[model samples]
Target: MLKFLKQVTDYTKGAVDAARFIGQGLSVTFDHMQRRPVTVQYPYEKLIPSERYRGRIHFEFDKCISCEVCVRVCPINLPVVDWEFNKEAKKKKLKHYSIDFGVCIFCGNCVEYCPTNCLSMTEEYELAAYDRHELNYDNVALGRLPYKVTQDPMVTPLRELAYLPKGVMNPHDLPEGARRAGKLPEEILDEMKETQDGESEAASANAK
Candidate 1:
């Protein structure tokens, strides 16, 4: 009789403890229910994100040298470089350059490998299209020239010469005779001076 009474007491204590735990759980759930929700309504308001975002790529055609630098670097071969004879100048010029956006991985390889500084990545990220072909770009249509450079008249003892665009790595620097063909204005001379100073500073720092 004494052992049975002890077991009953233990069982009763366990039941009370279970009831207390249930009450505490219910309290926590009720408290959460009374508070405001943290869910957001997307498309109406967006959260500001950090930088280091890789967006779409943009091409500056005029700066391109048709060297096939970007085309060769792209792992997917999305950038197509084509050219034909410019009858008026009797020189070969770019004919067709296109990129299929659908297959682009946004790896930035093409932009980095472009020798003419013709390719760059842009921050515009809304890339949506009903047809996949719409995402492609025509090189001639999109390849626009970048900034112009004026050479120094007094320095280097050579005539004023213009440098090629940023991304282009020319086979040979423009001939010295061609450099002397144009007279650089004061403003252009100043710009050239600034560029030279910047380059010198960069070189000095790199050596250090």
Candidate 2:
């Protein structure tokens, strides 16, 4: 009889505890209701997004070496890099650079793989449209290169060196013979080297 009584008491205690928890939750809800709401008025009030917020993708066609690194790096392969050699012009003209914004995962792989740092993320997120297909773009319309002939110093020369099977062959780091014969700005060179060094260190640490 005593055992039965004890069991009943324990069950009652458990029920009371659960009820108390529910009451506490409801109290919190009521407290929140009393405070001023933090939501912004959409389309009227502007809110600044955080630094790492991924929005629209921008590509600089001029700095693009036609390497197709962006196409390879994208998780969903949203960007299509295509080119055809113009027989009369004696140069390969970019036939198409299509980005299917509908499928982009915003992983930022394309920004990292760009040899010329031409691809970057922009902070414009209000891209509402009637049709999803409207999101696709021809990259050339963004802008033309050589607005100013600011030289890049870091690209290494195209030397007949032994195979480096893995990773990018930072042209600025290569021998002079393998690189384009032109005067590069010293500041750009230093910046590239510093970035490379930091990346290498970080990679090493990650491997360990």
Best prediction by TM-score: 2
Please give each candidate's TM-score.
0.47, 0.51
Candidate 1's residue-wise lDDT over 46-71, tens digit each?
A: 22221334566667766777788787
lDDT (tens digit, per residue) of candidate 2 on 121-208:
7655665679988777667533323211113233222221122222333322333334333334686899899999999999999999
RMSD of 2: 17.7
| Global lDDT scores for all candidate models | 0.64, 0.64
Which segments of model 1 are wrong by more than 4 Å? 1-51, 87-91, 140-208
Give the residue spans of candidate 2 off by over 4 A.
1-29, 33-36, 86-91, 140-208
TM-score of 2: 0.51
Residue 13 lDDT in model 2?
Answer: 100
Global local distance difference test of model 2? 0.64
